[model samples]
Target: MIHIVFNEADIPVLQQAISLDESLQGEVVVIRDDYAVGPLDHTYAGEGREARLNWWREVLAGGDYEGKTDTGEVDDFKTVAELVGTLRRNPEETIWIWAAQNKHDVSGYYWLLHFMKEFQGRVFILYLNNLPFLSEKGQLFYPIWLHSIPPKEFLKAKKLARPITLSEFEVDPDEWIRLCQEKKLVRILEGGKKLSQHDADFYDIDLAKFITVDWQKASKIINQFQHKNKHTTGDAFLLWRLKKLISDGGFDTQGEIRNMKDFEIKLKSQHQAETA
Candidate 1:
């Protein structure tokens, strides 16, 4: 059996789970790209893939991930092709896809399911949607990410695995394709497999609320936003949006914007206060 997960941080936790239960042992494969954001039209094809990568490049430019968006590093297409090849070569082999309740994992599941239609019965899913687990402190909590679950708890999570149904194979892929056609810049998990789409600047206004006349590090503002916001996005994307806010003269900045720590931002009103 092969284990597939969407988040990189979950890899070690899953490995620990496998260690506790030898019955669950398998090689873990991580799908690196976050499908919850950016373009998804024809992503399975070369032209569309390049277009998405180019978009990432634009987002990452002058930020922390600049020049780190190499195709080889973030190639989910290649990873899927290899997994498909493995399944074809060994018919007896099966796969287990693990996903948490968050949009990141669900969106990944949607994107990945499109490619696994042929191996319907062989593909299994363990979705931890609305499921409660015991944390290290022995407190009951519903985790949004798999890594938050203790290794011992995963032994229980493994029991939730079930083969991808024939109905799901037909229906889920259509759902993913529909999302691709919608071409929305953001996808938010409403509940279960349901996702709602929004425009690119959806978070811009809320993000602005965190800004003040008092200067703060770019990282500090992003940290506060993530802590307070119900729907959280990646810091790189938020930082990119911050640059956009700055460019639009909505905010004032000091220092280079190459990285979060390299710059500080404040409300444009601060400039008026200084002049007065």
Candidate 2:
């Protein structure tokens, strides 16, 4: 079962996700951030954060629901946990929600939860940045956790670590290497259209270039080639390399994977995490 959470802006995206999950029977919850915590009715005296937190705690104790938190404004998480618990007796089956702040990126909110310990490790995060219902176009990005892994709310690194892999469906590694070796600026083998490696190359370099660049152009070409050729470009071999990297503690170059490793160790020592 999938629990969906969303604000007004996320209505369309959330609706789409629900529609796609037609086979998965589940519940959908909505939180009007503008009116949460009895904002207009005036539930608590100082009932802003404190009231919200209290609501969450009560919800957590209730343990009835599972779904996304709508902007984490009201006792959203608490309520979500309550329901998620009913569906998931074993912690493994549980799903929790934490709504994120809009704009820029999720890093800020990610750190906020991490440092504040806002999560209890039982729920998952469904990012709503991409939701068209969002005032900001809500593009429907996938779920994201910071460097924080499962089952805890703690910050890892300012620059979070995430996994990335090249899909070899179009261009094989050998072909890419060969193109690079040949110094070819343009190659168009797949993707239903030809691509120019570079009709032009940028001379100026910026800080974001190195960090954000995925070399997608190169990877996609190879993936496309593989598809057109009706052949597999060795996903099994790549998975092996990925395993080795995880073992070696590969992560963002920000040097923060160490903290993630530390938290992982601590969690392991305290209780045996099923996935560990």
- Candidate 1 residue pairs in backbone clash: none
Name the weakest run of 10 consecutive residues (lDDT summed) in model 1: 267-276
Give one digit per residue, the lDDT tens place, for model 1 in 1-276: 999999889999999999999899889999999999999898788887888999999999999888878747888988999999999999999999999999999999999998898898999999999999999999999999999999999999999999999999989888888998898889999999999999888788888889998999999999999999888898888999888888887678899987999999998785575774
State, as a TM-score between 0 and 1, how close model 2 is to the true structure: 0.25
Name the candidate that leads on lDDT: 1
TM-score for candidate 1, residues paired by index: 0.96
Against the hidden true structure, what lDDT does model 1 obtain? 0.91
For model 1, the superposed segments whose C-alpha errors exceed 4 Å read 270-276
- The per-candidate count of clashes, in order, stands at 0, 31
Give per-residue lDDT, candidate 2, residue 63.
22
Residue 81's lDDT within candidate 1 is 92
Model 2 agreement with the true structure over 63-108: per-residue lDDT tens digits:
2221223345545345545654565565444342334433111212
lDDT of candidate 2 at residue 237, scale 0 to 100: 22
Candidate 2: residue 268 lDDT (0-100): 24
What candidate 2 gets wrong by more than 4 Å, as runs, is 23-25, 34-78, 84-92, 96-122, 128-276
